[model samples]
Target: MADLLDRRQRLAAALCLAAIDLPANAVAAGRQLMQAASVCPGVTMDEIPTNSRREALTKARDILNELISEASAP
Candidate 1:
């Protein structure tokens, strides 16, 4: 069960990186984010400025989606 959970977390991180179209040779910051996500599957931007936890999560998701779209554009 632990192995399965680990695999799922890794998969989630990989998917997030891929969605952002971040290559393996991406910047250090991007790599760091991927590494962090791999370990914390439920990562949130609560530490960031926001009125509420839900707002922070929504902001984070929107930012990620924007990055993905921008990266995917040719």
Candidate 2:
């Protein structure tokens, strides 16, 4: 489960990187930072709710966040 969550987070970070046109190395660095800080979920969903060509990616981010957050609930 944790591995799956991590993969989803990485995918979200990749989307963000593409949206902002970050270089590949920087994208990996950003993904690592977010994963370490455990804020990957929010960071990933940051651009969601804004309709655009990247809407699919944004939605994926939002869905990933929803899943992780729900799982974290007691």
Candidate 3:
């Protein structure tokens, strides 16, 4: 479970970085970020061991919030 979440977080970070690196004219970059951002809430909602749940949810929410802020940034 931890491995899965770690992979997902890494993938999300990579997507966000990719989006940031894209040319201003690349609409698909924003789409990619949005796609990654979309998964975060679901990740937060996923059932996990009680001991890990809060930390997982918090991380997911933080990533989601950061993605949102990045998307809205000029």
Candidate 4:
């Protein structure tokens, strides 16, 4: 969906903001980014119901925000 893709893009941009300074936990941050990027279902999983997909995206966004905050911390 366009909305999900847009949110994904926004989240990716936010994640890149952390890379600007290259945080001490760069590897962890990279991992989190990968997790955040995996909004779609995996090979083992069946197609996600529409509502479940929306919920997953929301959870990913929340995780992205936490990563951004941690990256911004002094």
Question: CA lDDT of each candidate?
Answer: 0.48, 0.53, 0.48, 0.44
| lDDT by residue (tens digit), candidate 2, 1-74 | 34555656655554554443323467675564455336344544454322343664666678678778978999
- Candidate 4's C-alpha runs over 4 A off are 1-51
What TM-score does structure 1 among the candidates reach? 0.34
Clashes per candidate (backbone, < 3 Å): 0, 0, 0, 0
For 14-67, candidate 4 gives per-residue lDDT tens digits of 333323223336677556445534643231112211233344455446767776
Best by TM-score: 2
Q: Using TM-score as the measure, what is the rank order of every candidate, best first?
A: 2, 1, 3, 4
lDDT (tens digit, per residue) of candidate 3 on 1-74: 34455445654553443334323445765565456556544433122212333443555567777767876999
Model 2 Cα shift for residue 50 (angstroms): 15
Off by over 4 Å in 2: 1-5, 20-53
Worst 10 residues of 4 by lDDT: 41-50
- The candidate maximizing lDDT is 2
Backbone collision tally, model 4: 0
Q: Cα-based RMSD of the predictions, in order?
A: 14.2, 9.0, 14.4, 15.3
- Give me the displacement of residue 46 in model 2, in angstroms: 21
Query: Of the pair 1 and 2, which is ahead by TM-score?
Result: 2
